[model samples]
Target: MNQVTGAPGTSRPGGRTARVREAVLRAAGDALVDKGIGGVDLAEVARRAEVGKTTVYRRWGTVPGLVADMLAEMAESSLPRARTGALDTDLAALAGLILKTLADARQGPLFRAIIAAAASDAQTAAALHRFYRVRIEEWAPCVNEAVARGDVPEGTDAAEVVRALSAPLYYRFLVSGDPLDAGVAERAAVAASAAARAGVYA
Candidate 1:
């Protein structure tokens, strides 16, 4: 077994693998935030991580592979959706979380860089798709619970509900360039809840 660090059973090189991987990931994310996908270089990442170039190459295989692994790591660390036992509260919480994440100074720019990368690279696009899918799956349970509670009718598309909660935040992040306030989360939840009841998600 790879002796682990930072959350146990998550390392491959004694207690240092997790730290080394996190360093590389942070370096890669910083590079992406500062220079976009076009500027990410494994050697530079190795230098930033103080790890050998061969180590990065051996672990990730290539740039796309590294990006995929980075995204997967992010998924592993993502917060679980709250179970408020009420559609409005649950969705509001979800929306708030989404807005907050998208508004994060480092995370936002890194994600935008990843989005740009996805536009031109098939592998990156696939990675992005997988990332979103994982997020949707993680949040879908709340919607299903809402349906079971009769807050929304049966057959509601749970993934769509989750997407609705995230949409406006992403829009404001990508376009409005405004602060993602609590008001946005409240309104988004309200809107999504209404739409779900109206069978928009059916």
Candidate 2:
């Protein structure tokens, strides 16, 4: 059996393979943030990652493939949903997380670039949708717990509630160009909680 050694700057399990993937994905993200999808090239990504071009080409095959893998990795590494035992508080926690991400200097640009890319690329759009689906599912349990506790209507759609909580923040981030703040995040959480309790999501 071939022994897998650790690659530099990577801490995940799977040793060298995981390290290479991390390096490549980080480089890809940086490229996307700096430029856009059209600007990202396999050669450039490999150079930035300090990996061989052939390795990158063989592993990812194409820009879309790499981007899809990047989304998968992001889904795997994303933070878990808040388990605060209350619908409002849990939604608030999720809102705060979304606010922080959308307001982040690097992450904000990265997401914008990805979203823009998704608009023009079918594969990227699919991958982006998948990423959101994973995120929504991860957070849906909070609303389900609320239902279990009788905080909301018994038939409330947990996933839709989670999506509702996030839609406003995303709108501000990607569409309105409005300033994102703690207050805005709090309001989104409150609105979602109220709507869920009112059976809007039922």
Best by lDDT: 2
Residue ranges of candidate 2 with Cα displaced over 4 Å: 1-13
Q: Give one digit per residue, the lDDT tens place, for model 2 in 166-198.
A: 999999898898988999999999999999999
Angstrom error of the Cα, residue 61, model 1: value is 2.0
Steric clashes per prediction: 0, 0
Off by over 4 Å in 1: 1-14
Report per-prediction Cα RMSD to one decimal.
4.5, 5.4
**Global CA lDDT computed for model 2:** 0.85
Instruction: Give the 10-residue window scoring lowest on summed lDDT in candidate 2.
Output: 1-10
Question: lDDT of each model, Cα atoms only?
Answer: 0.80, 0.85
lDDT of 2 at 89: 96
TM-score of each: 0.90, 0.92
Q: After superposition, how far is residue 148 of candidate 2 from its true place, in Å?
A: 1.1
